[model samples]
Target: MNRRDFLKLSGLTAASLALTTLRPRALQSPTRKLNFVILLADTMTAANLSLYGYPRRTTPHLERLAGRAIVYHSHYSGGNYTTPGTASLLTGSLPWTHRAINLGGLVRRQLADRNIFHLLGSNYHRVGFAQNLWADLFLRQFRADLDTHIPSPTFIHGQEKPLVSQFFKNDELGAYYALDDFLLSTHHVVNPTAGSASMGYLGLFYGLSNRDIGTADAEHPYGLPSNGYYFFKNSVLYDGICDTILDLHRRENPFFAYFHLMAPHSTYRPTRQFVDTLVEMEFPTKQFHPLGGRTNRRTLLEQRKVYDEYVANVDAEMGRLFDSLDAAGVLEDTYFIITSDHGEFFERGEYGHDTPLLYNPVIHIPLLVFAPGQSQRVDVHTPTSSADVLPTLLSLAGKDVPNGEGRPLPGLGGSEDGARPIFSVEAKQVSSFIPLSRTSISMVKGTKKLIHYRGYEKYPDAFELYDLQTDDEEKRDLYAEDTVTAERMKEELFDHLADAEKTLKK
Candidate 1:
């Protein structure tokens, strides 16, 4: 069946079914409040942005918007990985409580039935648009709370060529034809995994990397080629998502649109135009860290340049999205939030996320909230996790913030003095014998932070403490030296964990 036919067969066409199954009954209420637009960048580091004083012109649009929004300098994600961080953002609960640590996990089953989407659905229209495979995973969970969920186009038409065609030059076209036949007939293909099983399938076309059907060429297919930099300049994910936001702005109703951008992540490709701009800027290359080693200062500097350029590209696209919102006259009524699931580490031995080291580079993300009629900039020094996002957004919409582990943020007029202990958990995976096993749990109260390793056999685990008043980067380890401070922090952390367990049991 074609895409439309498949959607029809899936019972997605019935408005009543979609509304009843996808949304909460509270959304049917007559109150119309603030609309929400959450723009999430995958694997983005706040330190890379010019607005955050990265020494590069990375986020011109964001810098401009920061003047009119509240920029939280110390905002951290609840977890170090995508699924857990995103789960925390959506449910306002730590990963340990939400239990959505991996790719296939579902948030709806584990957490309380109260989500920002579910709470706002009672009064506003909820929609989502995601570009990355991980974002798609969250979208699947979000579908349970949204009034309308729009699946992003897997591939862009003019921007990206078929992956199969790019890899296999001579017979690439023919190969795609053969792969298409296999996909249509068998509904299952081994070479290039079909549907959403593989990352390649999540692109614009399903047959982008089918080797059996396409012709082989000199270029590498499985890995990114050296000349792969060209594709970043010409890629379509940014513009395509911008167009979606524009269309949603024109529709009637207070809407919640969650847009996820895949750029500035990995396979780090900044458009040639952006790269050229960086070159002209004459950024210091002495600090580039291509290999991600501690001593590769030159490589680190160069990688930062590349990361900044990619962020600039995203910023330009965001300018277009913001302009569209302003033109649609929804800018004032919208509660806009821009953040990331996690940050990337340039090869520093940390190529991607989920590192053993919980460094600030991986967890410290940019968080900016622009609520209607709120103009003053408020710096929230208190430690805030991604888990607080949902509750804060719900409260801003004049809805009762759901009862969850996350408390409403103080600066948004929802709560005051965010003094409660905040915790973050990371679960690498689960074993068959133990159902809900996790990797590590990190808790922060006041200035102290503790990380407990549960999945590993290591006893006493590990812990790190940072007095935010003095050390923000968390460079010095005070665990061993400051016994009294460490013990007090550990007690606070355990108390919060025990309380959460009791709440779950009840």
Candidate 2:
């Protein structure tokens, strides 16, 4: 660990002991009006952050903030990308249960109402905003629960509505996703989706205006390289989040606010000051596997350099946000949660999170919970999932957690439920509902992880096993070497899938 992180963790460890010794009610009152906020930073990978033992200082702000929060070192997302990952966080169910396994898909209609926003009930005012168009689909799916529903691209790029309206007018239409399938797939339309046409226009606009996806200038501002429907810069998005927090603070009752910010995701546009500083750092070269991945070594290293710069920029912005929350006195009375929808990959012949491969970098995300009156930091090293976030928050809010695959998070009054098995499934290439076809599934129990690939034309069902404790990089595969262990895990994984199918049959 870096000196700064070492000092912070030491201080937190001392504080945690004191807080735990005191009376439980002394921390915060359950009867008092409490607030909840999920600051979802898109694709902020745990593997890259210094807090998780990376040599580079990618998350100094979060590292300091960890002194007063609950940090989960082994947190995994439900899927490799925005759609299923964010859906799992929202609905407290895995991709298989939620059936939002495809890119830019919505939660299954049957499970839509059970979303956290709706389950929190009518007691607190609920608000939602997502800069990523794909994540906004799930929020739109649960629109009935939100008391204040802001436009997905509002307050971004300055004149967000007017600029985006050139392609994304009528915000309430959800960018006409149903119609999008028609236009993007077959150019036929009965009731044409307005947003589909806008997509082409917006793409052209971004192409013309955003010639440099990796440029940040004073004139352009906000590092906004593109004005497309799906992306935003952290510089701009963080400002809007602070403004929204200020607005929500004045409401009569407590509120449950969800802000899923898209930054540190792609294009990797950090400011001029951040670029080229960490360009020479050496990282481990990943060993190739048979599952299939292709990217040049130079390109992967370059992407990692830019991605680290972007993460630094986001860290600075988050520091400003923490100051604002502290000044506004929200820190002492809010259940503030910080996490990511998914993580990015810069190794094993992959740069971004387009996953046919379920490597650690693409699935492991950072999860920090800062409960009100939490004076000392407590770290939870147990493997956890994005799906558990909903149930955990519900338990804190004094609400009955609905019937879902995830239970209450550990280290927060939740005990082990028999032999807990954490699962993450990726099936963007195939049907959302039937994920086993053309898919990759990750099953984690203790330190051992099993990656299963199924229903591929070239590569049929196969498996790769890694003991994370010994092989964090996942360079060595032990599937053939350890038959007994591999077979046991495979049987357990199949049993879990069978249960998910049974639920679908219902």
Candidate 3:
């Protein structure tokens, strides 16, 4: 068969497989076990949401849902990007412990079994899915513990090329590293490819085919939303999620489902209805960092507008999904949690989360928990980390909370600690196996935040301190003025770093 014929046949085969695999089994009476659903939105920062006091009304749906849910106001992610941020959430440990610090990296083999899936155990039906390839690696790592591992492209539309990860299910990680990352690498800007000449020719054809299939329809005016790997529609994804939840509701056992959706991350393409609908607003101008991307303020504001619109679009679909599930009585026995892996940045001359700066916009994420039969909203202003999620979930499941850096989240079987230290690490440039020789660590203790930069040529051993209570914008740097607070925080930060590095030796 010709190349065109081969591609077409592959597409048809994939569709057939999806239809057969996704069809629900014979329905059974629901059990008494509690259900848990974690809905993660990639690169969604609380700073951009009206739910978190942003001037723009970007999340009306989430705001309405918060009426009966528990909202966390001061939540931070473990790292600036997907690998480490997601690893922390899954393992209930910081990036320093899990060592998933690099792009497309996996958790340390020794700590492999210490994830949420294993903690939930066989009593509950564990399910995992992620649209972001980087976040999907964690699911691939713990596939053995999962009762249902959904394919990344199961809900994606207009897929022409066969995915290496889907075909080689048993060895998805290795296959992805070899074929998708090296030989048939189409995503080059974020991930490096081996640059095979023959594969490049084939990739060109694939791109053309994909473009033809992924043309903007009437529903999506700007374009179909993508995760840099494939194109998908927000409505289709949400509908699939609702269907999955309904299927779970009919099952005999309780379930722990993690759906990591790729929206409002990048390539912000909202629907026609959401585009240009947000009020134009100005953000506070901050000094550019030496390590920043140096993007102009006007461009940053413009990108923020588009990002806000995309967030609104995602929120609308989420509202639909929740309403459908509630109508189906799925919410009666489920604990629904909504959060993000990491957050986006649009200030200090940086347009995305790729920069080394560990500012609030790039690390502060939203956390909302909806308990069964919840009626009144509960707000927790105590600072929390993504690492806290795993332990909290276990506690809610009536399981023993494991020993880790994270304690159960406040208002959920854990007490609030106002002075608790929350740390976020950024070390994409450093090797995951080695001790972190060069990195940026931000320590948030109560309302004060101290950012320490180590082993960089431009700003070696630098420090920036901000009292978030007073300067939430982080306009004023209090490193020099607040000598007592600065020295105390600096010492605490370094001492913690020293302790984390010591684990590498053993």
Candidate 4:
């Protein structure tokens, strides 16, 4: 039986009347105030994008847009995964301070009031939505500051699933994980959207309906392929985003629209044209460390090939979005920022971004700003953190950066704090309120970097150093080779951690 039919038999559906409403508020005069729109694409690593000099032509559309936008080459996510990375962007605080270190953790209650939405206040209509349930958690935490919150499922532009899911409110918790992957993952029949909890009985039906999509040799025949529980295609998601932007233009003047899209992530759903075009499909012959994860070279190459294709597909969708905004004349008055929550890794025996490793593939990301009235393109080679995004947006809106760890972007009335060590943390095993009891961290200053991995049962507490200017891939360990640099960076890393821990007491 299909998942929907199984759900009917199991009686797991709940009929709740409440539904999300995206109605426009009272129409007000367009007072020529600048609007801000953040296009947050989840799991889009910069290492794979052709815009960042990858061998594959993965991002031709973004290459076109980057000409007019301010692009940062060395931008890094605050955390290796969603919880910590998205929290850093919203809270303007690092993983240690915001403490979204756990898998599904939220920002600290004390610093919760200091988010971008709250800091922006009522001066503009603060709108927030994310297709990623993990990122949506942070938005829900900061919901008090939002003027309107469009639902994530609304991003699906075309026909939704069975009619029953529409009327009944789905169990959101069910969407968090799927039982289908237990047996069906290797065979692969159920698409990612099949896990959504919003459809109530329909969600359970999705759980029940893992159809026979043929063997692993045959890719998706009818349903979309999926790696995680979330099911959203970038093309449809981008269509909804374009529609959202134009709709907000019609709303009250000066709106802060934060649309976090789930695209270019896992399950690598690239269109036909983008698939298998690249020459190299085999994994690298790099020395095998046999560390944390189980992915081999062949698996890495397979995952990366599709991931690049999916990234290219998303880039094309972005091109359409830009065209729509330009046609509406909203681009002239809107501050558009394109970035990702975190990156994925294909190296170091890892397939996806679930590992605790903070390698360059997992942390390095793309950051671009198409500020209003920015006629000429600018590039910032200096290193920056995702934590700076909130303050940079604040600065663009003519507001102060607040007393947070982030500084504004260089082009937008901010300077590169290269002297101040930038930090990245991964603390999936620890609680949000407790800081630094068990965590993985990276400290970046100038060309030197130091990474600390602690509390992992597989990996002991250790410090690894790398010269980013020389080793961008972080394959070489410079800890023993460069003692002077390592010691200095270690001191800075611990000091920053100490400061972050002190915030907990306050």
Candidate 5:
């Protein structure tokens, strides 16, 4: 069985009834206030988008949208996966500080209050929704500050599986860990059963009953796009998002909405129209890493092709969402920010971001800010991190920027600082409470990148350096060849890590 079937069979098919709701009201909004809308597309890496000079025209809609937006060319995620990457965006801190390093982890309790929703204060109406259950955990964590927390399964087909977070709304984070992650665990890498014999038997019958629901249709040749637990149509999802925006517009207050979608993530299910219609090209074959499984190059390329088509399908839906919102005048007074939590990978004998490798394909995500009334496109070539988003949004809301690892993004409330060191961490194996003993840290300053792998049996304390300006593919290892730059960057990286470790003592 595939990942989706396995997850469903792990007893994630429980019935959920209760949902959080808010009263609908109508009043005139403040004339001078600006609404902020963050449209987060999960696993949307810049490595495959045409807007970022990728050979494939997978993101034609984004390319058109970029004409009236601010595009950052070298934006990186805080981590290689959803938990840490999303936590960094919400808290304006790196993985080391927030410590949401594990697969189903949450930020440190002490620093939990320092989130975007809480930082935005009570002035703006906050609405949050996420199809990605891991990303939705953060929304649940910050639900106290949210005026509206849309259910995770909003606007999907009726037969789709409901989230455990929805079932135990009062204790979503705890319930997810207890019921989903522990008792009914089906993550192949993490836990197959974990002694959940009863639930496994129950889920077997449930999966058998719902097996027909996953069959392909004429519209969807492969199958409906799924978030591992449920299937959903992109058209329906975008429609719901548009309707939510319109409803939010009717309210009296300016709003801050974060809609994290799970399209183009995995199960690479593109609509029939998008299948086999994009660019046909080849990527450079690179040396395989011990951490990256031994998936053949042919299989990787085939997976990449399907993934590109899925991305294109999502982009088309985005185009439709933009059109509908623009027609309703929602785009006129809203600062729409488009980005992703982390990225996907189909290289180096790997097919996804599950591997510990922190290469560009898994960490380099797209960042585009469509400011209110923006007419021309502006490009920022300087490298930026996901941590910058929280502080940047606070600045846009006229709030004081908090002291954190991130600064206001350039051209928003701050100027470009080329020397600023941006970092992405991969530490799923590390504990949230202790020091990062096992991690992969990638530091990028200017056009140079240094990747440090620690606590791996295959490669202990290894470092790989590359000048991104000269070798974007990272084929050349400059660590031994360029000792001066390597030593300088190594010192800075270790010093930063040392400082971050001091927090565990407190």
Candidate 6:
């Protein structure tokens, strides 16, 4: 039977057991396996964290936890954007192998026929709670096996809330209400009537009314109430995820919880308290990116201030989560992982992820793995990719991924010894206007790094080599300067690519 079918049957059997009386045998404890919690942040970069030596103390909790965890300092993402990065993480395979680089792309069923979630669901209860829409899309693919999928309700307005159209006297103006108009016009598949989707519609209506649908203020009610404006950085999402996790932890059944947070991503508004902290610290204001054809410097600065405040706010919430888990005495028993899907560029000529640049600021992410009773702080210098996370997690869970592109992380108990060269790929563009014909691939082995560009006529077959030991910032392109080193790195990268291609064919 497929993984989903097996899970359904097992869940039924598990429901009949007396959970309170059940306890995992000593043989099946940490030595054999343990529960897992992967906290994924959206559009987060390690460069901005205090753990990575950033000037700002953006991640005090992560830094404190790093002492007890194995931190992979040189970890990278498999893809430039969220969809591809997350898919690679879940499947433990490259984008080419997974084939889920774009929005509607499906993962290769042959190589990773069953994802980590599916595999866990077969043996354990799997639940996913995501705060972002993109993560919801990813979780939707495993709806049958997923025990629960809770989207962030921070910005949502219940249908019980009055509609904006009710305030308008003119019928035409009332019809102009974006939320009411869209809901009234669109065909509802599950519930044909308007009330069924009222909560969703009201959220959109209020969001549009305040002109803060996609901004930090979306978390606030009516975009008013100074205290409410800081809701984005509040512990709402963290609390929701923690409650779900605690619930699963209390259950006798083993469970896998994927908590994806939307904090420190955008709409950088932090709580008033956090804002006051930033003001006291007098954080430096850096115009990382220019306002492209815009004349809103004052507004933009205010937005950035909010963003900094939110980061600090999230850090505080993270502290709370750690404390709660420790108080529950399950902190060490849980296999905790913390990482981000992708990093935000803050307009440095790039406002978000999916940028053409292959800089560390965009792809380099913070990866921390904490196993139960494991105190060794091993820093893995060998380049690692997000694609390796799934297989690593599976290996920890006493499972196997036969054709996974990623290897189990080293230093972890029961981890294998084979470490392969890591590579990352980004499709140049998705739209015809931006020329979707090119591909950028980055390969790293030891201190040598190479970036290869294919299909761009001007830079076609161009390669850039860098000795990360000397130039970590990647400010200088050594491709033209060091021909011999570039050629060697290029050949090695090509060989790795060829092997990946062969594996895909098989």
Q: TM-score: which candidate is best?
A: 3
Give the Å shift of residue 243 in candidate 4: 1.0
How do all models score by TM-score?
A: 0.73, 0.88, 0.92, 0.83, 0.92, 0.74
RMSD of 1: 12.9
Q: How accurate is candidate 3 locally (lDDT)?
A: 0.86
Off by over 4 Å in 1: 1-33, 108-112, 158-239, 276-302, 374-376, 416-418, 431-438, 454-460, 502-506
> Which 10-residue window of candidate 5 scores lowest in summed lDDT?
15-24
- Which digits, one per residue and each the tens of the lDDT, describe model 5 over residues 129-195? 9989899888888889898999887877634432454678688778777776667655567667734
User: lDDT tens string, model 4, 1-506?
Assistant: 76534642232121010000100111122355778898988899998888887878888988888877777877889999889999999989898898888866778888889899999879888898876667876776776788876655564423222322112224332223333222122223334343334544454555446422211323332245332443445566677778878888987668999888777777667666666766674444545443457677777887888888788878888888997898788887788889998999888678789877787778888998876655545666667889888887787666777898888765565755558777889888787766666778988887788988887665677888998776777778899999998888888887778887887878
What lDDT does the true structure give each of the candidates?
Answer: 0.60, 0.77, 0.86, 0.72, 0.84, 0.62
Those runs of model 2 whose alpha carbons end farther than 4 Å from true positions after fitting are 1-28, 158-175, 178-227, 230-233, 416-418
- Measured on C-alpha atoms, candidate 5 has an lDDT of 0.84
Ranking by TM-score: 3, 5, 2, 4, 6, 1
Q: Give a tens-digit lDDT track for model 6, residues 1-506.
A: 76644653453343223111122321255544368889887767776677776666677877777666677777888876777778788778777667666643445556444677887655677887655545555665555567665543443322222334333333422332343334442224422455437566655465456544323343442232221112333465567667777888887777788877776676554555565455423323333322122324455445545555666677778778876876786665688888988765543334456455566766788898766654445555557789878877776677765566787665542232213557777773443123225777887766667887777655676677787767676656788888887887787777766776666557
- Residue 495 of model 5 has an lDDT of 91
lDDT of 1 by residue, 63-117 (tens): 8877666666667887777777877888888766776666435564645366667
Q: What's the CA RMSD for each of the models?
A: 12.9, 4.6, 11.9, 12.8, 10.3, 11.6
Indicate the TM-score of model 5: 0.92
Candidate 3 has its poorest 10 consecutive residues by lDDT at: 19-28
Q: Which stretches of candidate 6 lie over 4 Å from their true place?
A: 1-33, 109-112, 151-233, 276-308, 346-348, 413-419, 428-437, 457-459, 502-506
Ranking of models by lDDT: 3, 5, 2, 4, 6, 1
TM-score of predicted structure 4:
0.83
Per-residue error (Å), model 6, residue 385: 1.2
Give lDDT: candidate 5, residue 39: 93
Per-residue lDDT tens digits for candidate 3, residues 15-96, read 3333232111111223356789999999999999999999999999999998877788889999999999999999999998
**Predicted structure 1: lDDT:** 0.60
